[model samples]
Target: MRSVASRFAPYQELAEHLLQATISEPMDAAHDVGHLLRVWGNAERLMAEEGGDRSVLTAATLLHDCVHVPKDSPLRLSASSMAAEKAGRVLDSLNWTAGDVEKVRHAIEAHSFSAGIVPTTLEAKILQDADRLDAIGHIGIARCFHVSGQMNRPICDLFDPGADRRALDDRAFAMDHFQTKLLTLTGSFQTATGRRLARVRHDKVRDFLNGLLEEVLPDAMTVSH
Candidate 1:
């Protein structure tokens, strides 16, 4: 696997500068360097076919999560906009053109699912897809539990793990997130490549959810009886 610096190619210096400056701050396990690299990797795959400005995509992908609000924070919905604002400042320091800065800002701001901003540019669409791609499949499985642990959210509701009898609240149960978001993400892909890759990863998530249901549901039923 390529290092995050190597992934940026001719723009590696820019990536390195931000990594040392902005990215050096403390972050949760889910939003750390590994996540950045994975998102960039996903972006590269999408760019290979979707076609977007590499320099802008590189900067946006690197700084997309520069601001990390806790998942439960009231500020969570604005996290992407805040990150975009910070990215604009960082790029201004590096002397990027105002137009280019705005492009990066839009990509970063629209990339968040919670932010609910529709991506208008190809780069923004690609960034959004790439970031979301990291939220499904096997890696996504690990990330999900990692975050749940961090927030002390339970893996499921135990007696009603599937929430068949209760309201769905991902905040209270990690498994509920599958129903609320992760499982439905494939349909939300912005590009053809992203959608194609998403279908494959979506299956992995479904299979994992199925396997978990098989193991846990019966046990819960047994305990309830």
Candidate 2:
């Protein structure tokens, strides 16, 4: 199996151009270039297992968050749409074919959880799976806290670490995100490879949450008196 970078070597120039643009754009730590690359890498792995239009998947992954909105902004739900519009312009500048550009745009538009757009094409599904994959595992944990810190959200609610008693408010507590989104992603993947990988990553998150509950919940941590 070819490495992600090597498999996508043909589009490295375009990828680099996109990377340069992403670096110059103002984005939160959770949605930066590193996050983009991770998503692209995930796309590459998924694409290998599930064949799709590599050009569309690669371009979509690179430009997915180009027009990022703040997590708490009213425009948050529309961020993917905004990115799709910006990506179309960028792809036009790169002289990509109309059909190909449209495919890329649709993939970007449908990749976001908030957008709630069902992906029709295989490339779009791959892009969606790839982006969501990056929101789990250790990196996902880091990103959750990073975004939490940016939004002034706490790491966990001391009394309700799992958000069992109250409505899950990820914007107020990072751990609540697991119950709200991350834990639910494994069942939402669009590809077999994505589902396979998601299950592993999901287990990691579950373990972390269980450990956290043990440490934070008084009953869970009780010792014989």
Candidate 3:
């Protein structure tokens, strides 16, 4: 099927600009705009398979994380509102129509799992799926550690939810994320395509965690890293 990615003129044009802005920043191995684009690409594929309102879903998927501050950053807990605020200003500047802009805002605002905004539209759900899908595999693994490192979270934080959540310390947020959010996304995805892909990506996360525990455990043999 032809990609629905190119149908929305303003989003496409603005996404290019956002891509430029993100790429201009010197970054390494984590939640970058380049990765956001890939997430959007995957979202689009799922959208095509799931068959939803392409325009809104495409726009939402592309912009969902356009304003994220960082990996495992507190934004994972607190940024959706901020991202919504920023996205609103951006849509207004682009002269997007009121209705389309509202849809965009709704999708962005509702995309966060932590934000707990229940999705009211198919577009919102797809964007949520796409964003989470990006958080699951190798790219997901790399980004997770990178986020934890930035937060100064310990390697053991992966299994400790409460400590990570209460940490208030950005350093401990990554583990909180893995325990409370990242691993649970597959179960929460709203679409068939999203659910299926999430299952596969989630397995990668599951295996990684199990392998880590086995390797690191004193009785299991030896840890690789």
Point to the candidate with the largest TM-score: 1
Candidates ranked, most accurate by lDDT first: 1, 2, 3
lDDT of 1 at 11: 85
RMSD of each: 3.6, 4.3, 5.7
Between candidates 2 and 3, the one scoring higher on lDDT is 2
Give one digit per residue, the lDDT tens place, for model 2 in 117-146. 999999999999999999998888888888
Deviating ranges (above 4 Å) for candidate 2: 1-7, 220-225
TM-score of every prediction relative to native: 0.94, 0.91, 0.75
Give lDDT tens digits, candidate 1, residues 135-215. 999998889999999989999997899887799899999988887888888888899999999999988888888778778
Query: Per TM-score, what order, best first?
Result: 1, 2, 3
Q: Any residue pairs clashing in model 3, and if so which?
A: 151-171
| Global lDDT scores for all candidate models | 0.88, 0.83, 0.66
Identify the leading candidate in terms of lDDT: 1
Supply the global lDDT for candidate 3: 0.66
Q: Show pairs that collide, candidate 1.
A: none
